[model samples]
Target: SILKKGGIVPVFEPTKATAATLALELPLPSEDGVWTVLYPASAKAANTLEDGLCSRGFVVRRLNTYDTVPATWDTATLTSAQSTDIVTFASPSAVKVWSSRLGTLTPVACIGETSASAAKRIGFDLVRYPDLPGMDGWVNAILEVIESSSSSSLCKHNFKA
Candidate 1:
């Protein structure tokens, strides 16, 4: 809406999902126009699709607009807390943001394929993602993972509808 109404260049995260949205919404290769990407500082590579566009002669510029700082974990608090069953990540950045915070966990659920790939790269043992998209789909995938894993404790927590 912002792009169409106010001529605002869309600023997007570096992810397949964001790329797909941009491709569908925008016409590429404007000689005098610019597309800006707001990405994390720690990422090693540029946004995949945006960089691809630059190669193809589109003017895509990037800004390292954010940083991920893992929250300090307290040993005493964690030791007293109940064990986590499943950790959920909606974006690749979320996986990266939580990397230092996550020590060891099983049966991680990602919202989509891109995020699942990130989780796998981060050494999450069980990375599961929804076949469909969005929050409902991700939740269903998580439920499926929990059912398949046969974790009785998780099933007892009312995750199902």
Candidate 2:
């Protein structure tokens, strides 16, 4: 049991039924330092991830990504994109408090095909989505949209000089 103040919380073997939340099984917790960068602008849920890492005795660093796109591959490289008119969230957690931020403008995009499933579960009516999921997949998708937009812009500019 883990003692906190005057209370005791029993710790169960991770192999137990609570294991349902486990995203993976083979790779166990690491003793090495673990720093996680959370993107898509959800802070409260980030703490849960941080705490989990700390429970494993891992030094964790938390970084927030709230740039142009709702999410990205490189957490550090995730800067604001001025050209972003459409935004996507990686998962439902990213949208945990998104209702307050969804204003009258700006279209919404969702990460991966599975994100659609998440959105449906959360009842998000308007959300654009990517064909694939995860960072690499989402990055490729946003890159595609950027390239298309840039090319379209060039065509419209038609610079002679």
Candidate 3:
């Protein structure tokens, strides 16, 4: 939808480096032009995209869409999660929620760098994420962690998406 409307997206991977470089690549806004940004409500308040675009002379209209909220888990579910060999997370919110609830030292396998970074920041000792972001990459990361463990037995994995 954004592409059809002629909106530009960052070509580089989403990281601090990309954010810095993206500022240099954005085109100067036309006179009195406004850019509407639809973003997740859970995203950081200091939106880099809106800030960069506004600094480059565009009036940005930011809209908060759906938020990523923590899911409520029953005691039994939480206990099961704690017993797992590894926990897989698809989002930063999930990692934070899991850490808060279980506070276990079990290893984590993330679907992407963002989730992995969150897990590490939340004090998880062992975090793994694949180079690419997708189900295949996520599964590979989980497999890698499982394979490297001293136990050769099948791993009981817990997925939080």
lDDT of 1 by residue, 43-101 (tens): 44346656665655555556666555555668975553336777788767778766665
Q: Which residue pairs show backbone clashes in model 2?
A: 87-109, 88-109
**Model 2 spans > 4 angstroms off:** 1-84, 103-106, 121-123, 143-161
Q: Pick the candidate with the highest TM-score.
A: 3
TM-score of each: 0.62, 0.31, 0.65
Give the Cα-based TM-score of candidate 3 against the true structure.
0.65
**Clash count per candidate:** 0, 2, 0
RMSD of each: 5.5, 14.6, 6.0
* 10 residues in a row with least lDDT, candidate 3: 152-161
lDDT of 3: 0.68
The alpha-carbon lDDT assigned to residue 31 of candidate 2 equals 48
For candidate 1, list the clashing residue pairs, or say none: none
lDDT per residue for candidate 2 within 1-161, as digits (tens), equals: 22445596634234321112222221444546553433233343335445554565445555654433343335333334333344576665555434334432333456655444555566665455554334655665555544444544433644221
| Clash pairs, model 3 backbone | none
Report lDDT per candidate: 0.65, 0.46, 0.68
